[model samples]
Target: MSLVAEHVSVSIDRADLLADVSFTAAPGRVHSLIGPNGAGKSTLLGVLAGDRAPDAGRVLLRGRRLDEWPLRELARERAVLTQEHGVTFAFRSREIVEMGRHPWARTPAEDDDEREIARAMAVTDVAHLADRPVAHLSGGEKARVALARVLAQRAPVLLLDEPTAALDLRHQEDVLRLARAQAADGDAVVVVLHDLNLAAAYSDEITLLQRGRVAAHGSPAEVLTAERIEDVYGQAVEVIEHPRSGVPLVLPVR
Candidate 1:
């Protein structure tokens, strides 16, 4: 499935959060949204996920208008991991992950619920904490559990907002690697990322947002130039080829 946003805009209290933004998330690729704080990365993700209706323009999934899809059907088509991973009640990690299966209730896919949940928890390395209360888990653990929930959803389109924020260096790499693996499995993955290097490393395409608009959108090499980064982020930076991976490495100048 492909998710496309055409001239999407969002305004609140007279402030534009996103303006005339156009983007596409195609299957078998990882698309990263990168920008400084307040640059509308999360807002744009929300719009693409259909959680936030755009004030102007529209979002299409599989060439169908996003709003036209039924809620249950939409949930089966895409899975979202928002920035906040708060669980109000004290639910066990396993129970939380099982929530992802709710959309498949009464359907044939429900038969895979147990297997999917277990696979997701294991992939996220949260299986050991399955019986633990989500409220008692550490930040990174909680984040992983939240991710497992999204994974268990088994949707073709995955939209993640700042998924690495709470993770340590190792887990950060794990999460992005998992994203790449998902894309390799023929899923469309769109992620909001603050780490430019990580984005450059894992993303097949990138959209650089700046002040509610798209500053640049293309391959990492094309969009993550030193000059473009400095101009959009207002910081001087050096871009170099990674010694091992050959992807762009962004270094901030002091």
Candidate 2:
């Protein structure tokens, strides 16, 4: 289930936030979307997930236009995990997760659905908070729960916007590992990451965006050069091979 955005541009109030953006996220691969703040990373993800309509060009899912697919059908195909939001209701953690199943479901719950929810919570390390009120959880705990909701959605395409921003180093690795597993299981996973090294470690492909357009797109080895990092991020960064895993390691020179 690959997603292709062909010359897509998003404009609001006569301001072009994203211009002529185009890229293909190959199926069963983790494609990292890396850019500085206000570079339109989240806007692009919203367009890719069909949450926002592009002012120009098109978004295609497997050769079909996004508008051609029913909203519910599209929901079944892809899921988006944005920055965590406030939960006005005093819902239990399990109840919050179960909302992800609403797109394909008519009933409140199912046997398989519960198991999937539990699995997602366990993977996010939020199972301990299952019975807790969502409103009472800490920021990081809530983030994990929100991710669990997306996992319960079980879509083939997963779009994560700064997923590890609120997590500790250990949970950051945990979340990225889970995302890699989802990609390995034949899903197209696009993650917006501020940490370039983590992106390099987990992604099969990297799409670097700068000033609302693609600056580079390729494997981490191909796109994450020191020169390229400086060009896109406006900072000197050292790209070296990780001694342990052999992946590209990005070290910012302060």
Candidate 3:
């Protein structure tokens, strides 16, 4: 299913967060949102995930209004990984992952839930931490465990807000790889990324936001030009093609 947002706008306490943002995240592809600080990428993500309502426009999932979907049905269709992971509970890592199954509890698929949880943990590399209390783990460890929980949900549409924010280099790449794998399996993946290079390399399409609106949206080669990056980011940057992948690599020019 596709996720589409049109003319979306958000405002809080007279502050405009997102203005007329529009984009489509199609199934079987990865769509990334990227921008400089305070560009409203996170705010826009919240709207897309139905966590926040747009003051002006609407978000649609598979052609239906987002608010129209039943909460339980929506939970089974789209999974979200937000930026914050501040649980202070003493739950084991796998136990936290099992929470994703709440939507499926006592359902017919309940029997396969254990295997799914195990697979999700192994893939996110949190299987070894299965016995560890979530509060006792490091920030990166907690991030990985949070990711495993989202994966265990096995939703067709994923909205991830900085899913790699706390990871090391290897784990960062692993997270993006997992996003790509999910998209390749015909899921719609919408991610908010701070790393322009990672966004260019992994996304089938990128939406660049400036202030509260989209600055550019298209293929990485088209949208991530040096000129656009400099204008939107307020800094001189060099956009070069990657040697192995031919994707745009954003580098600041000092």
Candidate 4:
């Protein structure tokens, strides 16, 4: 599976949010979308997930237009996890995770589905909160539960919007490692990340956005240069190679 956004641009309320934005994510690869706030990182993900339409370009899945795919068909193959999760209805953690199956599954109450839900809970380290209400969990805990929901989707393409933003350091690594494993298993994972070091460590390719355009796109070594970081982020960033993983490590200037 692969995703390609071609000359994609989005406009809202007389403002251009994304301009000629484009990138591709192939199977077994993790593509990180990095940018400053309002750079349209989340907007691009929304278009890819079919939640929003591009105003001037097209989203392609393996060269086919995304608009041609049915909603159920698309949902069965792709899953999205957004930044803020507001659970208006008070639902149990288990119930919330089980909702991921609703696209292709008719009976989420089945024993097999329950087992999958439990496995997702365990993987996200939220099994202990399974019986708790989603509204009762802490911010990080709720984020993990929401992650469990998408993981349960078992989709080939995963779109995550700053998935680790609310997580603690340990959980951040845990969740990212899991996403990497999924990509290794032949899934395509596209994540929006603010933490450049984390993006460098897990992403096979980095798509750097600046002012609604693609500033850079390539391997971390090729894209995350100190000069580029300084130009796009408007801050001094020291790019160091990880001692163990040989990936880029970004340090902020004080």
Candidate 5:
């Protein structure tokens, strides 16, 4: 099973934002989308999550087109975490996560909703904040709480946009590690990341986009190179092998 982006394109008014872009986020792995600002990472993610309709091509989940999937079935199949997590209420953190169970409401799955919620919170290291008001939390804390909600969703596919943008170093690693663990469990995890090091460390495959088009798509070793980094990011960077892990490590050139 895979979340496929088949020759997707997008245009606003008369300008193109994406053109003939294609991607495949396969099950049982973590795929990362990386690019400079305005590279259409979030736009592509929105299409994959079925929130935006492309002007050309389509997004498919498993083998079914995204537009054709019933809303409830799509919710059950995948969970989307956008850049913004809006909470209008002063609801407790637990309440926010419990909302993830909405798809299972009135169904047999409802019986274990609380258990699922608890497990999700625990995994995201937010269980202790379950009783706290979501609005009172710090940005990092809120990000983790938001992530707990998605974990509670128990969807087979995860599409996250900059999931670690507001986190501390430790928590940043925490989130990526959890993403890896989710992929290890056979879930398809697709994340948009700005930090190339983190993506190199955790992603099984990386898709590099430039000007709304794919520049490279391959294993980290194949896509992330000193030359490619300089060409796409327009900054001098040195790509080196990790001392032990051998994954690519990107460092700014002096």
Candidate 6:
């Protein structure tokens, strides 16, 4: 599935949160949104997920307007992982994961519920924590559990908002690698990332936003240049090539 945002704009209290932003997340590609804080990365992601209505412009999923899709249909088409992973009640980890299969209830797909839930938990390395109360888990554990729920949904378009924020270095790599694997399996993955290096390493295309507008949009090499990073992030940085992958390595100059 292809998720597209065209001329999308959002405003809050007379302030523009996003202005004329256009983006595309195509199958078999990992497209990343990267920018400084308050650059509207989360806001734009919310719009793309159909959680917030844009003040202007439109969002499309597979050539159809987002609003045109029914809520259940939309849920089956896209899975969103927001920054907040808090659960009000003490739901078990496995139970939380099972929620992702709710959309397929009563349908033939529901027969795979058990298998999919277990697969998602195992893939996220949270299978051992299945029966544990999510409220008792650490922040990183909760994040992984939340991700397991999203993965269990089996949605084609993934809208992840800083999915690795609470994870350690190794788990961060694990999450991004899973994202890449999903894209390789022909899912359209759109991730909001703060780590420019990870974005450069995993993203097939990058959109750099500043003050609600697009600063650059292209491959990592084209959009993540030292000059562009410094201009948008207001920090001096040096770009080097990774010895193994040859992707751009961003190091802040101190």
* Top candidate when judged by lDDT against the true structure: 1
Better of 1 and 6 by lDDT: 1
Q: Clashes in model 4: which pairs?
A: none
Residue-level lDDT tens digits of model 2 in 188-218: 9999999999999999999888878888999
lDDT of 1 by residue, 27-51 (tens): 9999999999999999999999999
Task: Please report, as a residue range, the 10-residue window in candidate 5 with the lowest summed lDDT.
Answer: 80-89
User: Candidates' TM-scores?
Assistant: 0.99, 0.95, 0.98, 0.96, 0.98, 0.99
In order of lDDT, best first, we have 1, 6, 5, 3, 4, 2
Give the total clashing residue pairs for model 5. 0
Higher-scoring candidate on TM-score, 4 or 6: 6
Runs of candidate 5 with Cα error greater than 4 angstroms are none
lDDT score, candidate 2: 0.90
Instruction: Write the residue-wise lDDT of candidate 3 on 26-64 in tens digits.
Output: 999999999999999889888888889899999999899
Model 2, poorest ten-residue lDDT window?
A: 103-112
Model 3 misplacement above 4 A = none
Candidates' C-alpha lDDT:
0.97, 0.90, 0.91, 0.91, 0.93, 0.95
lDDT comparison, 3 vs 4, better candidate: 3
Per-residue lDDT of 76 in model 4 = 80
Worst 10-residue lDDT window for candidate 6 reads 8-17
lDDT value, residue 128 of candidate 1 = 100
Clash pairs, model 6 backbone: none
Tell me the tens digit of each residue's lDDT in model 5 across 1-254. Answer: 69999999998997778889999998899999999999999999999999999999989888899999999989999998889876888999999999888988888988989899999999889999999999999998899999999999899999999999999999999999999999999999999999999999999999999988999999999999999999999999999999999999999998
